[model samples]
Target: MTLSRLACLLLAAAPLALSAPARAQAQGQPQGQASPAPGRTLRVAPHADLRTLDPVFASIVITRMHGLMIYETLFAWDSKLRPHPQMVESFSTSEDGLTWSFRLREGLRFHDGQPVTARDVIASLKRWMGRDTVGGKLAEYTAALEASDDRGFSLKLKRPTGMVPFALGSAVGQIPAIMRESDAATDPMKPVTDTIGSGPFRFNRAEWRSGARVVYDRNADYRPRAEPADGLAGGRVVKLDRVEWVIMPDPATAAAALQTGEIDIWEQPGQDLIPVIGRSREVRVERYSSLPNQAMLRPNHLYPPFNDPRARLALAYATDQADFLAAGFGDERWWKRCGSYFVCGGPNGTEAGAAGYAKPDLDTARRLLAESGYKGETLVLTSSYDIAHIGRMAEVAGEALRKIGMNVDVQFADWGTVTTRQANRGPVDQGGWNLFVTTASGATMQSPITNIGTNMACARAWAGWPCDEEAERLRNAVAEARDEAGRMAATEALHRRLAEMQPYRVLGQYDQPYARRANISGVLEAPVMVFWNIEKR
Candidate 1:
């Protein structure tokens, strides 16, 4: 299917036209609770908070999972990261490949029972256009957004955005379809009392049980697969009336709850409990593949002594991938050798430059560091210790750098703090930091519009010097590729370029290894991260 390629726009068109003021509003109206509850509810606890609910914002896995329930994008990706049409019934680009039109789906109504109009798209994009708006990042790519008809909208591009639809598939695409003028008055991201969305499920009351548990009742509007999914279809709507997501922060406690029936599902199942869950009589164990890298993010590789390609190569050579992988995850192989910035490596994963990839060349490393004109700058490496072994990764990488006449200053921080700091134009005083590992869910691997920019292009923008002009050009190309063939070729080219330059060393890919009891049925899994699709036992 031909997808609509929309870019991030920076200009504001109109507000969401919201109703409520900027004050702290109640979460949502508590209504139609099942038997206690009516709709199916599931429990989930990942390593971190999901990304923002506004699809246009940064594609955080957690946010996507939550937004998955309340929002709909123009294009959607299936389990295999394949783009699938959702909100838009049909869409096509113009002959010149600049303007695009979308035919909206009919009979679609937001949870508030309001008819979704084309203007909604414009307003959503407008709110997202401003700095830090939902799809704020889109401002960099898009020129303007204009609604054409009641049922469709038209997006004009200042530059050719051949990859707009895939972008629309992202979080920004899931913006509020029907916002009141008042809702748009203030920040659109704050929870709205009137949660309006046109999705399979509707928003319900959420109860935060003081870090111990959070329960959410479902809306009856939730429509299930009436037909079969090749075969595993035909379940009566859903089995459970309400899926109470007990946010057990402790993994072991989460497993224990699942075992004791305090909780029905263990979203963040620990490895220690994996064996027990597999053999449990009351629960069921299901397995799935994950993205190749456990820790896949770009580190600022442009600092002086290390800025030299040889120094960067030396760091890569010194890194022990096998030992690092073993320490991070005992048996997680979701990540293979990925030379490119894109995670969830495609068939083109092993293309040209990535063939003979992983080799721990200590001797070569030493030689390269010396050649890089080592003026002796302490390599200040920072990373997220939130993930199991990411801090350990910094240590390992630091040791490798130290071996080659490089003094490494390893500093670790919480994922959110580091991410927030970087998003707000990185640390200034520290000479932009020699090396740092940022936490990116989609970076690890995401579906549909998995361009190299959100994963790597932004890496350039975030690095000490944004990785230079040449790197930006290559990254933009990867983001702007029109078709699969063009995308594949460009991605391969990028992989080769980064590998040659050693922009950031590939630490590990994502293997979303979670624990679930024997009872939970109809749970869908995404390799890298994000777990919104699940059913209760």
Candidate 2:
């Protein structure tokens, strides 16, 4: 069905309303205290539901957004992609740069009222380092992470490198969110159910409904940074007394809510509905980040067909970036055809080895498939039904693969289920997936070390587990390069190798704008949507 027709159908349906009991539970009114002012609450229609609260466990954007509402990081990235101190009061590196010392800002406290300390920071970093791509790179250089006092901690590196702050401050991929030591002590593979954090808001777990809404109240005792908000850095002053995530999976329902002022912000509006939403003077659609979102086609590397490089190359040859972009995003103004493994127009964007597969070639794809000795194995393609663009991308991919004489099975599920099922490494009959479509912000694709898609660390690589010794060596070279020229050269080489290996297919890139009520102000332009520093005036 067309998105416009879907929007029309959904808009005709009556809007969903939040239950009164849920609101009362969210507010948690005390006996003697007066109710909060009407305008003090900010209701947001997020792109997806908040299923995974632990950011360390899953890399989903909704989970990361939830973590940002309550969790605080040691450092944060600014608009220029530079790292700055967020939780740290003071920090310095030794002359040789092998030792780094940091002291926590005074008055930092978790939602439970416990003081933030070096122990919490150490534990959080250790946990984050195990899962995140950039954090894993940082772990390779670390010798010891020790706490000197209640508020001070030091990281002793085995070798001097300049990526310490970047890893901790990364706004892309898995965020390095600091949690209480006890919560951080949970296994990295396991989800931490505790919601306690030291950020400007507190997660109201009592009011959370799985598919309906998630609530957060402002942390009254929270402290803000002195600097003004820039990107995800600086002060996180919460002007709103309460922030509620009213989950609206339907774009038309969310767009209508924004028009009626029932929802303060709609995080991601469908490209086709932008014109409809813009017709209302009460709502304004604005692109929040300068970086576009890059779409990827990832294949399971542990399975039979994709495990062979020739089969992977056949998939890439069959893919046409223009078709995927047009199918996923209807409007050309909102999307672009980019073949760069690293995002096009980014710092390290390049087309070193993209010439061969710049356009679709059915003959080459069939020839490669025949060479790979594939005996018509059914490729299971998993996609999310809730996310429109992702589901469209999967459909386009399935069509392309079938044209190349490959058996395809497209499976549709909710975003949470898709994310969970993609982690399995077994065969398709055993709950494993052969292919899926996903996306990453342009900021995350800017560097070889930061981009999880390019990781080839064998068992430790991203979900696909694409492993190559030469790709790993090139990635290390880019990370260890001291000068810009050296870094660029190493990056180009790595990009070339990646194009040959076909770890994942780059479909295209596009910018998605956020629609908000006109009265909403102080929305910071970061790679990810952040709720702090926003005023619902």
Candidate 3:
């Protein structure tokens, strides 16, 4: 019902959307060539605008997409989810497993024509280890990360940590993107203005217009590995001469552009318009994300009502996943009812603590609210109207929270606004939020070590900042586990604690697909949609 109202609002808002010509100009396309020759230039309409240039600074999917285009990592995950060396030519670990030595591939050069060195890699690793979840765990055991030579580096740990290689190859959440030594030293909290890396594509800084358009040109100097491309690893052969990411906030406008061949690929087609696009012979719709994304309702643990674990558990128990999924995806086929906080079929995925996760009992919720003495506290629930999926989830969840007797204040803002606002840790009255809905790529939730949200490290924890010593202990145990059985046991314990704490309500896992013209090819069906190896012909 809320989405129906939002639809009418969207139609009224269409006129305000950016036009093709204006978008083309913003992307630095010539006046006459509103639609560039398809094969040479691949025009894309991403789901959101490229807000941040620095990949390590923000873990948002949009920013990560940009980072993947312009930067290269030392290691990457293959299609089979195995870690492989990307920038590194070879590596070895001591028998004790405390020291890891890595040698860089020869002739790795940044966009500015400077050669990539071990110092750059060391600096980047240090910065990323301070921010990323897996890297943070590695940092706990790391005694030193230093350059062994101009082309090699070494990481000495206090004890054996089997996760070092995996951490270096991590693909989600503040990815360990290698940058220039100077840019690597830039504060992780601040955005790096420069976009220089030894990736397949080079950022056209002169053409970037934040919320309007961003452009990248193929890097002819980039040296790909001899191995064939597999997922995020191996050779990233750039077939297109240029890639243009045009920002169109309205799905209707983006669909129209795609239908007219104005854009080659629609990174995320709105669910409401899928049927319309499917009817077109020129356009084809398909799922792109390798793993389903799980939308979550994160409750701020710093504020009233939600400050209590009982209140958190009560909200999680009361909420229904179907309501939110239906509102966001529109079709039942696009979503799965997974009560799991981890990826449903992933390594650590299980239904152990999920029995009551999706079983909504409003009576129980109200009683728990009474027990917790939630005295009419205003829960400021914010939603991102800019992204259709997130907006619908937030609206649906806001209604559900109201049904469970929450004093809900539903605020709709752009994704950028929501991202900025959700970071405020102050009181709700002082511009902080009590509840917000966001989704994680299945890659991020593969295991407890990779799932930043599940880590209950309080002051250093993600968004909601749920601090539970027992949860942290369980997570550490899983990280340090020597075998699969031990890992599963620790994960089960962690999941049980997560259920009780309910820091973030795992709404459900849903498939968000992309659309492309029949001629477009080489689109990788990976967790983070990549533009490399894509051919327009």
Best by TM-score: 2
Using lDDT as the measure, which candidate wins?
Answer: 2
TM-score to true structure, per model: 0.73, 0.95, 0.94
lDDT of 2 by residue, 449-505 (tens): 788888888777788889999998898888788999999999899889999999998
Worst ten-residue run, lDDT, model 2?
Answer: 14-23
**Per-residue lDDT for 1-537 in model 1, tens only?**
011111011011011112122101221323443235323445554555432334434344444455555655566545554445566778888888778888877866666766767877667656645422224335556777777788888887767865565456543223323343344334643434444566555544454333233344444554443333211112113444444444434444445455555445554454434565556587654544434433543545444665577776676777766666555555554334444455535444533454344677778877877788876756566666655456655666666667766777877766655544444433436434567653344322332234322233333232333354554566567667778788777766666776776656666454545565555566653433233344554
Q: Show where candidate 2 strays beyond 4 Å.
A: 1-11, 14-36
- Winner on TM-score between 1 and 2 is 2
Question: What is the number of residue pairs that collide in model 3?
Answer: 0
Which residue runs of candidate 3 sit more than 4 Å off their true CA positions? Answer: 1-38
RMSD each, Å: 11.1, 2.7, 2.9
- From the highest lDDT down, the ranking of the candidates is 2, 3, 1
Error of 1 at 396 (Å): 2.9
